[model samples]
Target: MKFIDEYLSDIKDKGLYRELKFFNRPQSKYTSIGNKRMLLMASNNYLDLCNDDRLKDAAEKAIHTYGVGSGGSRLTTGSYELHDQLEKKIAIFKGTEAAILFNTGYMANIGTITAIADKEWIIFSDALNHASIIDGCRLSGAKIVVYKHCDMDDLQEKIKVYKGNKRFIVTDGVFSMDGDIAPLDKIVKLAKENNILTMVDDAHGTGVLGDNGTGCVEYFNLKGQVDIQLGTLSKALASEGGFVAGTKSLVTYLRHKARSFIYSTALSPAMIAVSLCSLDIVKNEKERRVKLLENSKWFQWELRKLGFNVLESNTVIIALVIGNAEKTIKLSEKLFEKGIFISAIRPPTVPEHTSRLRITLMSSHNREELKYVLDKLKEAGMELGII
Candidate 1:
């Protein structure tokens, strides 16, 4: 207990301590945290489908029909018709031969990587890959070679130096923090040239990118070319669980061999129903994607015009790099006081000296809400000299 107290004190002294603030309401354009109602800009509910009537109806019906919980791990008593139905819908949505669901995106990455790669294999990873992927590589016992973020030349150079029997290259489809896209076209080309397998964690891209929101792989027109396409239902889909879409053979192999999927309890029936309904909405509603992209572009343009550094973002996720952790926290607090809810992201989620306000836009955010946010941001930025 003394050691734990000392460690917490050290973190607080460093201005890196984090505490949770409860929001006693559903996720939407406006969120109620305690007694304050604020415009939400820190959520991953990019499509604003979390509280949609259709999804709620589906969840309610599922609860009535299927009950509240899955009985056990998928390999035991948890597999049900809803689980198989969601997997099929996901595969069709992703334009893959088949798909399999997991408890979470983190588990999907960890399970898939460790199942396929071993000490004899080499994994060439992006420096800015998600923490789950990093852990996956470590657990795989594979030789990890990290290249500079999105540096194709560095990746090629590292692959040339490695003479391993098997090789896999993994990266995020859309980097979560920086909001820039991976060069998947070039990556696929290189993978083909080197006979190396490829995997993309499209947690942020699914239900947002591409013509019909099929994700980055389909957006790049490399659907069948990439080996593994992984994503989560919690982000844009406004539900819970993760999925891997690929050839029937790959899905079969993971279903049998991935320890995480084998041992973890299946997603609840209500959550599965929510994801299914979300997919149906994503397929039919193109307006949501358009609105989301427009809002993101307008917000980014306004911020950049105010001389704020928004990095190289081309998605709904945007970051204002504040450099110092304490300053970032202060700015976030200021925004909250102004009735705007945004996140102050600090290490080790991001690197040191790169603390930021990670802002995200949803399709449901109106022009008035955006204008208000911008106005308050400008006022705060001037006050803090962040602009």
Candidate 2:
């Protein structure tokens, strides 16, 4: 594979190459890497429930009831009572008529989009939608029209230009890298006026938004207005699985047509149980998310006070733009050496010359730990000439 070597060399030269960093401890505000206890600031466990004992107990109980792996695909012998219960629970949580589960959020997006739209359809997607949505639109063989990020006017203009009866708009409820939320209320209005369908992948919003942590749909107070609601159990829920909530007919259609759902093995009973328990925790422990958001606001303000270009975000995900890929990596490395772990997001994940440090905060992180992180970031930013 000469081409593979060439590609690797090209990325290395461009400072776009990526490698894995192994963690020796459970995912939390603090974790160990190679015997060094590092402060974790780049995890998606926003509510800090990943290491909760209750979730562990739930998983263990489910494991005792049903052995680990799901025997087969959902349509086969893999279907369990626990799976059915979770799906029903998800529907109730999201305020939808029904719901279906997938192996991951990526799978859910790719599967649902392809299942709903095809060659005859046109998809008006947000410019900053997650890559999974982009892939799903591409695989569907539909004409994809990308509007400017979170610009409703651009969407309206494109909607008028791309005329199709079978048209739907898909967007990420909360963009992962930029940490900005899409204008779902305006999108829903446009969809209604234009007679188009709407889908929102609330992967980052689930368990971290809305009064009851029901996600973006509830956050916007447009409960039953949106057509398809997609989410993941992995983020704040601290579990592993993806799901789509919509009308019963849509769930039925996806089960028959979505290849990712029809072919992949069902999620294990233990993971499903963990998801179930975590959802309950998210509902009961609203204070966790409340504190998480409060700390995020304080943290972002502090970063700006240090002269960093922090993006405007209401969610826990924060983006501190550094513009240069190599410099961003250097800043991350410097911070790591200072006992903090924040990811350097580079090209392809973000726009060129817009490399950034994607810092995420957990509810369990206190002011003392955050102040320490800010201090470290200030030192690194000054050394790298980022501030």
Candidate 3:
């Protein structure tokens, strides 16, 4: 406890201390934090389907039919009809021959990476990949090579020297912190030339990118070419699970060999139902994606016009880098006072002196809401001398 307190003090002194903030209701364009109703720019519910009636109806029906929980792992009695159905749907959605479900996106990454690679193999990972991917590579006992963020030349150079029995390349389709798209086309080309297996975690890209919301693989027309596609149900899909979509053989192998999937409890019926409904909505609703993209472009353009640096963001997520962690926190708090709720991302989550306001857009956010948030952001930026 004394060591923990010392560490806490160090974090606090460095301006990296974080505290949990509670929202009293379900995620939406607006959320109630304590007594204050704030514009929710920090949520990952890109499609705003978390509170959608269709998902709610499906969830209620599922609860009535399948009860509250999946009492065992997928290898055991927990493999319900809904679980199977969702996996099949996800496979189809991702343009893969088969799919396997994991309890969370974190488990999916960890399990799949460790299951496939080991001491004999080498893994080439992007420097800016999610923590889950980093942990997975560590657990795999493989030689982990990290290329500079989205630097294909660096990736190619590093991967060329590895003469291992097997080689794997892992990257995020969308970098979560920088809000930039990976050069996946070039990565795929390099992987193909080197006979390397490719895995993309399209957590933020699913239900938002590509034609028909299939994600970055489909967006770049590399659907069948990418060896493995991993995604989350929780972000844009408004659900609670993750899936690995690939060839039938790959799915079968992971189902049998992936420790996380074999040992972890299956996702609940309600969550599965929500993903099913969300997928259907995503497939049918093209307008939402269009509106969301348009909004993101407009917001970023306005921020740039106001002399704020919005670096290379072409998606629903945008980051306004404010340098110092203390200043970033101050800007976030100042904006919060004006009823906007952008999150301040600091060190460990991001590099030191590059702390920022991570602004995310939802399909449900309209022009009026965007204008109001932008106005507050300008005020906050000016007050902090960040613009």
Candidate 4:
């Protein structure tokens, strides 16, 4: 009851002990959480494809044909037909020479980043990158230099200062917490000028941006300029896995070398098959993206109109800054009682003194539901004096 217990007690005493919420139904804009239908603005299911009929059907067929699990690592008897097929489809969608799948998004980043670079190389990371990317850089055995979030000038200055012989630059295509798109075009230009390898973790950007959901690379029209495109099937794809899209040789290298892939079991057949079906839906259903954008636009405007501190958000992710940890927790509880499910994100998920109600939007949410959530958020803010 010394170090670990004392820290755990501090979290509870500060009213910051994180706990999971119960959802008793399928994922959607509005779902049953403990028998009460609640507006869901917390899930990472961006395109609302989790309940898409085609994806579910494809997964069912995969289960029947290929069974539930891959049973072994990809190199050790787990490279089933579905896994290969999913990788091929993803590569085609992302306009990459090839792609490789991992059991989770975390593994995809961790494995690929660590395997590709060596101790002699330096990794330039963004300050606001997701945890997976941060950990991946740490595992790479490369000298890491963190640039200011989305500040190209800072990046340029660092490139001038760093003394590494081989340089790798990495950033999230979209900042998850702040909900701002990375300047991929600018980043690419800088990386090219400095002769640095570029990689983007487009986990939140894919399926929600670019032409036909190709992600930030497509958005920037730098299809092959970046060295690697790291993404997750779990978010926009509405499946439960992750993959890396890159040159054919890079993928081949990862297949043999990435420890996470070499050591872990393969992703399930159903998930891979479902991802294939999900990507197809993304290609055809442009209207879903339109709807999602409309929701984000309207909500961002509404949050600002309501005088909430919403940062530069242009996607499904929105935030109402309630900087105090205790206040953010209280606001979240109030919203939950009002039948809205949101997450109270605090340090170190985000930086300290920036605790907030991290509201995420979905394609399934209609105008009225969005309005309802906005209204509740306003009322809760006023009552709690959070705004």
Candidate 5:
């Protein structure tokens, strides 16, 4: 009782304790979070297809065809026709020999990383990689070397210092917090030069990057250069699953050994069906991406002009640096009250003193809503003395 009370008290004192906000309806540009129906700008639905009628219909069709769940682990009785079709489609979309799906992106990253790497391998990871990657590295039993954030020279120096034949360089294709893209252009070149295999967690890159939405490798025009590319259907794909695209042998290896994949139940049939439709939507509808880019660029310019410290987010996930967790949380709550719902991101999600309001834009948002969010943000900034 004493220990629990003390920890709860400390969390309360820090103003960092979080709880769930029940979103009443479909996730859109203006939807309910908690009691307020605000201008929702904190979602990763970059193409705005989550609530699309086509995807909804696809989901319904899947439910009727395959029921609610996969019923067991994939190797057992779970691998249905839907999973096989989805896997084949994903491989074709990603230009890989094979693709494997996991229930969640976290599981995919952790399972794949931990399964492939062993004591013989050395992992050189970017400092700002997603938490899933960090945890995966820990479980991999590989000697880890942390390089400076996106610093190629530091990565090179580390690569030179290490003398392992099985050297693996892992990085997030898009740094989730700061929203800056990785130097995949540089990372790929260096990886090839050093003969080190490369793995990119393209969680934020798929369905949002590249012409075909093939992710960072395609975006950077480094398709075959990257050995492993991990993508998620949850973000821009607007579904709930993760995939690793690589050589047929690599994916086959993961299928047998990855504990998360081996033991956990497969993704629902509805999600897989919906994800297929999502891919089609991404390919056919270019307007969504155009609108998304316009919104992102406009917001970034306006936020900076308004004298807010909107960091180097060249993509969809922009951050307004509030510098303190308490202030960030307070701003988020106040914005919620005003019907402008954006989330506060804090450490260990971000580095200390870099607490921010993680403002994400969606393709479904119109110009008026974007303008309103900005104007309200201005008011909130002035009220909070951040301006």
Candidate 6:
């Protein structure tokens, strides 16, 4: 308890303390917090389909058919017709031979990595991959050689030094915090030349990238080239669950070996129904992603013109770097007071001195709404001497 108190005190002093803010309404571009409507700019609901009537209807219908909870884990009594359909659909969507579901994206990464590798194997991981990926690599007990963030040269050099018969390279397709796309094309090419297997976690890319919105593999035209493709149905798809798409052998292997999938109770029938319906929406509503990306580009440009150091990104995620952790939180608080909700990301979510305001755009957000956000940001930045 004393150590816990000291640790809490240290983080509070360092401006790294985090607390939750409850919302009275559903997660959308605008939601009510304490009965006050706030402009939400920090959500991962990329397509703004969290509150879609179609998804709600689908969930309602499924509830009538399957009731609430999954009776047991998939290997037990949890597997349903909907799960089978979704797995097949996901395989087709991702252009893989087969797919398997996990409780969350974190589970998918950790479960898959530990299942595939061990102490004798080596893993080449990106420096800025999600915590789940990092944890997965650590849990595997493999030699993890971290390369520079999105630097193919570093990856190439490291791969040369870390030679092994059972080796694989893993990276986040779109880094969650940095808002930068990984060079999957170059990484895939490197993997092929080195005879190393490749794994990509496209948690942020699915439903927001590529012509058909299949994710980073399609974005770089590397379908079926990467050995493992991990993704989530919770973000742009506006549902709940994570999955991996790969060859049938890999799928079968995980189904038998992955602990997370074997031990966890399956997602409820209603949630599965929502995921199924949302996938259809993602496939048909191409314009939503187009407009969302367009708005993101313009928003980033405006923030840069106001003297903010915004990271370069092609997706709906925008990282407005503030550098100082305390100031970043202050800026976020100032915006929240102005009726906008943006998250202040700090260490160890990011490296020390690289704190930022991570602004995510929703498809439903129009120019008028974004312009208002920009004006507020400009005022706050000038007041805080951040500009």
Residue-level lDDT tens digits of model 6 in 43-90: 999999999999999999999999999899999999999999999999
User: Looking at model 6, how many pairs of residues clash?
Assistant: 0
TM-score winner between candidates 3 and 4: 3
Task: Determine which window of 10 residues in candidate 6 has minimal summed lDDT.
Answer: 28-37
Q: Model 1 clash tally? A: 0
Which runs of model 1 end up more than 4 angstroms from their true locations? none
Clashing pairs in 2: none
Question: What RMSD does model 1 have?
Answer: 0.8
Put down candidate 2 lDDT per residue, 44-72, tens digits, no spaces: 99988888999999999999999999999
Q: What is the lDDT of residue 351 in candidate 5?
A: 88
Candidate 4: regions farther than 4 A off: none
**TM-score of each prediction:** 0.99, 0.99, 0.99, 0.98, 0.98, 0.99
Q: Please estimate how well model 2 matches the true structure, expressed as its whole-model Cα lDDT.
A: 0.95
- Model 6 score (lDDT): 0.95
In model 1, state the lDDT of residue 260: 92
Better by lDDT, candidate 5 or 3: 3
The count of backbone overlaps in candidate 2 is 0
Candidates in order: C-alpha RMSD to true structure: 0.8, 0.7, 0.8, 1.2, 1.1, 0.6
| Candidate 5 lDDT by residue in tens digits, 246-330 | 8999999999999999999888899999999998888888777777867898899999999999987767889899998999998
TM-score, prediction 6: 0.99
